[model samples]
Target: MDSKNRAKWACFGEIFEAVAQQGIDELDAVEALLAALRNGLRAYGYRRQFTFNESGKVERLPRDIYPQPVPVAIWRDSGTPKGDLTSIWQDDPEEPEVWISIDWVSGAVESLDWELTNFEHLRTDFSAIRIPRKEADHLLSDLAGRPKKRAGRPLGPSSPWEKEQVAAALRMIDGGDTRPATAIATGLTDTALIGKALESQQRRLTWGIKTALTGNAKNSANNKRD
Candidate 1:
């Protein structure tokens, strides 16, 4: 066997061994294998297709449609035709075609096939796959809302009010309140401040400072009662 085929079978063997170790039934085994294959294809930028028959006409349905008709066959494709260069079809002369025929009622994979030719195209460089412009923009927008890490020593509570705020936030957190709720109670709108309060609370517990503070509070209360 060629190196490519050998590698493919070896990977399949590993998946089979893992599924066998779980001691599942035949149906479960088939489902697990299907899931693994679908996930692997998605990771390589393959898009799914749902084929449906309506009134004697076959149609491709979008993923979000409700009451999804069981697909006669599942198809995944990736190539420059769709502005994606993440699949083997990027080098193929014809359009991409990879599909798995399914028996939905019996929950069995009927057949699996793909279009390929033996023309010596260079091996795919997955790391160098170019992202579509729209996807790249979306990723950038998502990252814009996240906090950026700063270099050098981390900053702590800079003022007495800030220290008190952190303490109040920590108390709310200890009461099992979520960060958003704690933020509202403590008037801490900045998520970074909420994070700092959690860190401070952890440090106090680690250093036994919480115990000391509790003891001091109890002694003050006793003195007042005296």
Candidate 2:
């Protein structure tokens, strides 16, 4: 677990400790503790659907509202740096957060980095959303919250995976940010994350990004036909 998880779970102890120790004096600690306690009560809840039967009685529907999570082949490419995200999706916050991700080498979600939130629920429930990696890349890019490009110049990212933040940094430049300032803000010089801007590396990154975009588009077209 990461520091964020540890911090979140720590909220549970805030309330009991407040009274048992005769009240927590630290303001931030008190707030986090209280917030954690409140979250615990509401966080695990999920929506339940109801259906009206022929007899006019409201019947409780089965708990599995969605289809099981489908395991898919993880996209792999040397482009975009190591540990750079290949895929990401919105998680059901109500479910315990699992950073479930594809393990490309094994073609399995079961890996050291990620896990299914509820394997049983997935096995019995949740539908498949098989968007190709191409479309997925575009969708993921949008989800990352990039702004639309302006007319004068297209601000293509240095790395294929540099979606939202790159755009944000570009905006800073358009608003009169110096190279040094932009570099500092966006890690423009952060070669450590990706690598040196070599032409071959760029080609590979471009291909990966294109593959993701095309795959997502193909999935959408197929869905329409269905």
Error of 2 at 172 (Å): 16
Candidate 1 lDDT tens digits, 19-102: 345453434443433443344432122123333234542323443322122222232332111112112232234652332333
Candidate 1 Cα outliers beyond 4 Å, as residue runs: 1-10, 39-164, 167-200, 204-226
Error (Å) of candidate 2 at residue 220 is: 0.7
Q: Where does candidate 2 stray beyond 4 Å?
A: 1-197
lDDT of 2: 0.35
Per-residue alpha-carbon lDDT of model 2 for 68-147, expressed as tens digits?
33322212211121232222332453754333342221222321123245332221111122223333233333433557
> Among these predicted structures, which one has the highest TM-score?
1
Looking at model 1, which ten-residue stretch has the lowest summed lDDT? 121-130
